[model samples]
Target: MVRNHSEDRTESIILPDGKIDLFLFLDDGVNFEIFIGGICNKPIVKHPFPKSVMFAISFYPMAAEYVFKRSFSDFLNKKIILPPGYMGFYREDMQNFEGFYRKACVTMQRIVTDPIDTRKVKLFDLINRSKGETKVEAIASEIGWSSREINRYFRKWLGITLKTYIDIIKFCNSLKQVKSGHFYPELSYADQSHFIRTVKKFSGTRPTVLGKNENDRFIQLTTLSDD
Candidate 1:
């Protein structure tokens, strides 16, 4: 029998973006995403547990070494992103996940073109190296993309800025730990407060309030902001 225990599910959906992500796989940092297409049903990215179940057709492991110095957006939103821009190609069909992951992979790979940039190829490896310590300058320098271009690629791919995406990753990880009774809690409930504040600041809710509580559902943070 398979013993089951809940752990952090590495995933997030950014508000107003056409991407939903399944983070932390294929490598420690790089994961997958399903693009939101009004005309296309993209793939559903998958994580380990309580996650939407989907079969992943693995891209060739050798594909991981591909590096890219340019951004993914040269063709992405411009409607020029080729299907082979990213993955090495595998077709996964899963009725359970409604084909979310497969469609996303196909869509992402659609952006590929000849002479793939070695810098962009490194994005996958960089994600693995990030480990919560990645800095904007470093990311910008490594792939030879400017900070602005990198932000555009991140915004296009992950549906959020790199820093924001990282925050969401950290928050969701801590959340999983808390739910599984593995989180370190301060006697003063400092974790809860910080979690709530951070969520409220970014997600516009208390941390424990999301997903599990209907009331936790909230309007986007920008609507509540003082800008």
Candidate 2:
């Protein structure tokens, strides 16, 4: 959840964080628009109109597939507009963030009736537990699943390979350290150069510039908390 309170229009560079997001945009707190931000491997620049309030919910890979009941392959690197009342949400729910959050929770719970695959559940648990530092082969061994099968599932559901998804997770983990002015590699990168290169590959900027984050241009950096 996030909102832009600035009276003047502002630009924000959003870095990939390996999650699909559903965004609700209220221009001048009256007109409404909704967009789904698909998983991407690069940075995206956004310009929100003044007095616009934005709310978004990030979905896990498994929940995204089951709740939405569709493949996200076509949504990669794209922001697709959703039709009105796409998910049982209406103008009344958008009146307040609190109501919207409750409504969204109920909608998601009501829709997700299918049983989840245990292997995929374990796969995600291992990835989260390792913070994306574990190799695919190691994860496969730990979860008792084949590396080929894992990659096949990733490609089929998320439109990316296992290695790419792992890289994105690693990059996201580095964001907190970078936000606190720690530019050196700390998340199992080969070295400082490898860390910088990976950050640039995903964020389109070097570590120093991202650390400086002039004018709070990077949305994720500005929102991070040192907890």
Candidate 3:
């Protein structure tokens, strides 16, 4: 959940984190909008209205594909507005975050009428468990799926290559360290240069600049919690 308590609009930098998000934007307890944000390869600058609240649910690729049965390929780096009452969600759900979350869970369970592939589950689990540091071929071999098929499924459902997705995962996992002023590579990155390049590629800035944040402009860094 994100809320802007100030009287003026705020700018936020949203970095890629390999998750699709559904957002409910409520303005001053009156008007509202629903939108879905897809996986982005780079940072996005968002301007939210002042004195508004945003309720959001983040979904992994598997959930988006199996549970929601929706393809986000067309929404890369973009957000699409969802109609009112879409998927049984209504303005009334915005009364509070906890109630909204409970209702969303129930709705998701009801939407899953078909069995999800176990292999796909293992594939995603491995990537997350490894913090996207493992080799793609190794993940495919362990999951009993071919690399080609895995990549195809990723592109079809998530709108990106498997390799790119893994990189995003690695970058996301490194954020905590980066936020603490550790600019050096802590994951599977080869060296400082490689790490810097990846950080710049996704964030459009070097590690030092990102860590400084400079007025708490980076939403991910500002809101990150230790896990």
Who wins the TM-score comparison? 3
TM-score preference between candidates 2 and 3, better one: 3
Q: How do these models rank on lDDT, best leading?
A: 3, 2, 1
TM-score, candidate number 1 = 0.40
Please report, in order, the local distance difference test score of every candidate based on alpha carbons: 0.39, 0.86, 0.90
| Candidate 2 TM-score versus the reference | 0.95
Model 3, position 114, has a per-residue lDDT of 86
lDDT of 1 by residue, 82-154 (tens): 2422334222322324454556557556644456656666854675445334667777788788889867766
In terms of lDDT, which candidate is stronger, 1 or 3? 3
Which window of ten consecutive residues has the lowest lDDT sum in model 2? 1-10
Model 3 misplaced stretches (Cα beyond 4 Å): none
Give one digit per residue, the lDDT tens place, for model 2 in 145-190. 8999989888888889889998999999999989889999998999
Task: List ranges where model 1 is wrong by over 4 Å.
Answer: 1-115, 155-159, 182-195, 201-204, 209-227
Q: Relative to the unseen true structure, what is the C-alpha lDDT of residue 8 in candidate 1, on a scale of 0 to 100?
A: 45
Report the Cα lDDT for residue 59, model 3.
88
Please state every model's RMSD to the true fold in angstroms. Answer: 12.5, 1.3, 1.2
* N/CA/C clash count, model 1: 31
Instruction: Pick the lDDT winner.
Output: 3
